[model samples]
Target: MNTSPSPSGAHHVEEGASVRLGALVPLTRPGWVEAGRHLLAGLDLAVTEVNDAGGIGGRPLELVVRDTAADPERAAAAVDDLAGLGVAAVVGEYHSVVARSAAARADALGVPYLCSSAVLDALTEQPTEWVARLAPAQSHGWRIYADFLLGAGRHRIAVVTQPSVYWASGTRILRDHLAARGGTVVELDANELTPEALCDALVDHGATALLLLVGQPEPAVPIVRAVRSDRRLAELLVGAPAGQPEFAEWAAVLGADGAGIPFLRYLPEHLGPLGERVGKELRARLGEAPSFVAFEGWDAVTVLADVLRSHGTDRAAIAGAWPDVAVEGTRGTIRFSRTPGIGVRQWAWPPVQVVDRDPTDADRFRILRTG
Candidate 1:
């Protein structure tokens, strides 16, 4: 966990120079900004813990963070800056499209990056040299969602997605997983065309349940209303893990039917075991309660800290050393891609209902159905 230079290598590594790491997280957006702050807090706490424990090989760990604003374009620029700073590695890219851009930048600069978020299915193909994952991939969500539907003997699913690449890429995985379960999909492109277009979609897509792959919060209103307005569309809901915050405004504006799929790794109030520990540490550091993004941040930092602790802080060393490390994440079971340079796993693909209000606990979210 230390970044200090040993006696033999002390001459090469300047003494007391902080080993800088970078994070390209979406920090300007509404809920995600809160998420980014939490992640930053966790990273800060992790770095503190590392230094208090004697630092990474005796070198102080310094983190350089950039706000990608939940935009892929901004994320690309942020990664460029991180690479310019000669950071050993970076952690966390929330949106897959943003990660794609960062991955490209990481490739050109030869910097190691961990895609802790942005589980889009196609992110694995992004060209990067030193990258690791603290979570599973976007396809995992599809696979899990598919498993749920299949276990229920539900076939013929309706698909709704943003034209944005995140959902676009993930929907394919959903399709493949559903197909594996003998489910046929009737697809509709809800590519931010218009409210009318979105409203018409529910009437058009013929299936028992609907899968929305959009990452934005605004569209939920029209979609939810469309589904509720149409009595023909039963089991109207989303398959992605959009929590209550993102879905809240839409619900308040258009009112929700209390139906849909919400695939989340950890809930805020009931964030499992790791969440309990991480949450406490995060609160201590940030001086406030952690939000969703904090978990993502902790996942990235702890993974990087572990790799640095075991493998050494050098880029190649971190990359070469991370293959077999499996750490218990906030959500649970975070393992790196044994392929090292390959990528992160898409995780937390479990499905819950997209409810109007936060249920007392996770159980009600899973138990109730409105579509």
Candidate 2:
């Protein structure tokens, strides 16, 4: 997991060694750990392929790793360690809050930060050349959900979100979009999330569809369990798969969704060449499904590698190439603006729905609409 500490001033690449790429990712639980493993595998494969074809600017590549763990304090310290190693730039997997905290540290230290999975608007609302995202912001995903569900007869929507900014504000964008489509937000957070309290909110508001913006399994698991507990109120429950894998550990409990599709941009079990091959390689090394977060780790490395390879110790050339490069990611095309606050210019891989046990194939998630 690359958890060791780096010596001070080690951020600079060796005198004539290939340029180095740095990545920060969460190695611990409740989200994207397995899939992340596979993602890194695919990314390494991409890097190797790039180098084998012919070195960029006649230099090889070095990829470094840092564990961001999901702790704000630890994440802050992590960027410092990475900076000391003279990393060219970074991309990582974690929450937008961590991205925000770490990016500030990275920027001040003169290291650019590009996020691959963290997707909250607050993470990138102010323009900065050193920070950017490879993932789309929350509102974009929410809008897609709102447009499709409302058109498909999901009226009287109830937005069950936690107090987190990721859920509270971003989900509101979906709420506003839905209201514009003639779908009323029947219920908001409704404060107290007790079973009795939730029932009262649903009963009083008469919500027909439920939009879940909650991440972490604590409240999310309970909310889903509560929804499942009352069969009388079953309705559409949906959100990104990145946040649901935590719930997968206790699948028996979270699997309660018999009537909804947990959205996922990339599904590891069903993978392409780079993904399938790398998944196996990572398992051989990491001994797991390669948390999807690993891909964020891997992509961060490859992107930095490709970016730096073009620069060859020229940080400016490296930084400039970042804003408009696109790669065919497992989810879809991954592209971004090197500038920050633009959020990720990328869009979600076309939404894939779980229909009749056939998500293993691409035909499953039909495109009813686009947000």
For all predicted structures, in order, the TM-scores are 0.77, 0.76
Writing each residue's lDDT as its tens digit, candidate 1 over 1-371 gives 11232221121224467777887767687325555666677777777777888777788888887888877777778877776676778887666677777876665555667776565555646433355555445555456556766665567677666677766666677678777667887767666445456546555655666666554455655665566666565555445443433323333444435433454443433468768887888777777656545677777777777777787656656655555667766765565543332343333332222232343332234432311
What tens digits encode model 2's per-residue C-alpha lDDT throughout 44-108? Answer: 65567667766556666656766666666777788788666666666675666767777666555
Stretches of candidate 2 exceeding 4 Å from the true structure:
1-12, 29-62, 186-191, 235-253, 256-259, 264-297, 324-334, 338-371
Each model's lDDT: 0.60, 0.56
Q: What TM-score would candidate 1 get against the native?
A: 0.77
- lDDT score for residue 137 of model 2: 66
Error of 2 at 357 (Å): 7.0
RMSD of model 1 against the true structure: 5.8
